[model samples]
Target: MAISYSGYLNLPHGFRSHDILAFHDRDSEQTAERVNYSKNLLEKGILWQGMPACLILQFKKKQQVAITLLAEGGKDVSELEILPIVQRMLGLNQDIDDFEKAHYRHPQLGTLVKKQAGLRVPLSSTPFEALAWAITGQQISLAAAISIRRKLIKALGITHSCGLYCHPNAEVITQLGQDKLHQVGYSKTKAKTLFNLSRGVIENTLPLDDWLTQQTPVEEISKKLIEVPGIGPWTISYGLLRGYSWLNGSLHGDAGVRRGLQKLLGLESKVTAEEAEKWLAPFTPWRALVAAHLWMSL
Candidate 1:
């Protein structure tokens, strides 16, 4: 039998479900896609206590969100347990009013923010997933990275009866081993980093959960993540942004960010990383959001 729960949440001012859906739908890889977004609904498979369940979020006309979680085959999960995960995935907890107010009059991002108000950073279901994605996308085209990600999930993730794959957590990835990762098209360095990251999580040495629970400072976690081999500033920054919603991470090293800046500036030449960094410095704590707005502009 399938078990289910439903609830309603007041949408934040300027919240646009389409923007969140578009961000989630960016990767078009196969393998029983974990997240499925349509005009008014989103279906996603999420693992809780190692059991996979399907979550549905349906947007309503009055800025109210209807959330539902369906667990198949008598698997037990509480609405309380699932709501927080839903909140994170939807970025409901991330307040963007300050970012909007601060940048609404700016030269470059002003118009973009106004047009894209209530844009929130859609977070990974788990920190490990974000870290894994950052490693997977390093120095690779987005399409190629998404292809590899599909393979990885197909190889190791638990599939719900709903036909969606629950993103593999650290324990699942660790058991797959580096050899299997190579089969999924991860380079040796990336495979090694995955192994290292998964092991750290397994051993509690990385303390990703602790960091999230305690709301640790981004600099503190970034310092720790940087020590892992094959994990550079870009990886750390991207991971923190997607994983923790730390909006200050400088994404100057991202190609899409540079391209967005170039287009924004109407420059004929490519924007250098240094140039991007300098331009973004004024944004300070909202740099990642600024980068996000830039990506949307593109």
Candidate 2:
């Protein structure tokens, strides 16, 4: 029998369900599993430490959000565990003031921020998932990357409701060979890197969860992530931007980000790496938000 459970999360002011949904809705990947919109509410399925559940989150009123967690067998998860999961996934606790300061420096940012208020950098429900996404998306366009991700999920992910699938966990990755992933649209190198990453995690060589929970600085985390094969500075920055909401993170070498930066700065041509850094340096501690604003502008 299907089991049902529900929960509530109190959100701070400026939290908007629409903003969160928009983030998911804009994903260039397969739609149904990424998020579902129905009956005036949005639903997303997530795995909490390998436990599958569907979360319904939406703003109900001032300082309040309505949340419901549905899982088979009514599996019990403590409030402490569930709350942080909701907060981090939806970025309910991320402060936008860091981004707001950028608007103060650049008036154009004011309009973008106002238009996209309550916009938070959405994150993977799990840290390893974040790492996996970063690795999977490398060297591909957003649509192509997400398409590959969807195929990977369907091939290996834990089954969920409505014909959706959760992102495959590291353990599942271990069970699959490189050929298995390549058939699902991964390049040979991506497949190998992911296989190695899964092994690294299982072997405790890659402690992603520790980085998330502990007080390691973003720089330190970036340093550690880059040491892994197929993970680079851009991936580290992208991960930090999504998971940590690190304001100083830059999508320095990202093609889209470079284009956005060029357009934002009124440059006639694309910028070199050093030029990008030089231009973005003035927005320290908010460079990531600046990137967000540039994306919004485009």
Candidate 3:
């Protein structure tokens, strides 16, 4: 079905055109293409056009916002719960101030280029997709991860009318088997991990969506995530941050984040996992944003 989605998110001060570009780049290249294809501009919010959908968005000083979605026929806007879906997808539900404080300025790295009070935190609606992607990304270059993901998605992801690919659900992955994933270039261990994660999601062993609304502490969530085979601390933390949008969470072991911090602090080598936690202490609620910025810096 063809559906267009768009919305304005209140951004924080120091937020710039480049920052938005950088954020899109960090998240997904396909999304970046969608954003650019829409011909979006900083002054004009975000503007996009394509087969699946097209849209325009405008944000004012990270406060007031507006959005327009254009879809060709299959589903009516009102019937599809568009607003809530867009809000979640754009991460409008998060508090930018909280995020900013959680990812405070580093004593050694200096100030961030943008310091807005309400920057948006983008997330995937499909937690399974996020978790699976996080697993695929472990210990690999971002470019390599994307290549594998593209191959896997092409082989298994759901496709819409305009050729837009939606991530497959856990059930689909579980049914696909480890051998299929291996064919997509996943290491044997990685394939096993993906299958195990898929099994957890399918059988309710890992209650992903429930955790989002549950009162469980981040530590508890982290522990549960780690209980799954192939999901280590870094993978769990990454899932919490991106899939669940858990504020204050940091992926200390992420190579990209570590490298970014090293460059930001002028270190000779990547910060130790322990040191990374210490270094990120000041940016409590917004550690995710700090990670976002670090990704951009690199």
Which candidate leads the pack in TM-score?
1
Instruction: Summarize candidate 1's per-residue lDDT along 1-298 as a digit string, tens digits.
Output: 3666778877776677887666666567534333445447777766766677777778888888888777765455666667777677778777688888988999878888888887888888778888999999999999898889888878885888888887888888889999999988999889999999999999988989789878998888988898899999999989998888888899999999999999988999999999999999999888998999888888
Q: Tell me, what's the RMSD of every candidate?
A: 1.9, 2.6, 5.3
- Top candidate (lDDT): 1
Error of 3 at 97 (Å): 1.9
Q: Is candidate 1 or candidate 3 better by lDDT?
A: 1
Q: TM-score of each candidate?
A: 0.93, 0.87, 0.75
Q: Give each model's whole-structure lDDT.
A: 0.83, 0.71, 0.63
TM for candidate 2 is 0.87
| lDDT, model 2, position 200 | 79
TM-score of 3: 0.75
Clashes of 3: 13
Tens digits of per-residue lDDT, candidate 3, 1-298, equal: 3434455555444444444434444436463123442444311111121123433344455454455555554344552445554455566566765444543454543365343334555665446667887899989988898888778867874544444554566777888999999999999999999998888877887877676656467887777778777788778767776677665677677777788888888889768877877777777666666776676677
Worst 10 residues of 3 by lDDT: 42-51
lDDT of 2 by residue, 1-298 (tens): 2435466777777665665676666455543345445533656666644666666666676666677766654566667767876788777666676566546546545666676766677776677777778888897888888787778876775756744465667888989878998999988888888888788778877777777778578877877677777878887888776766566786777777777777766788778877777777877777776677667667
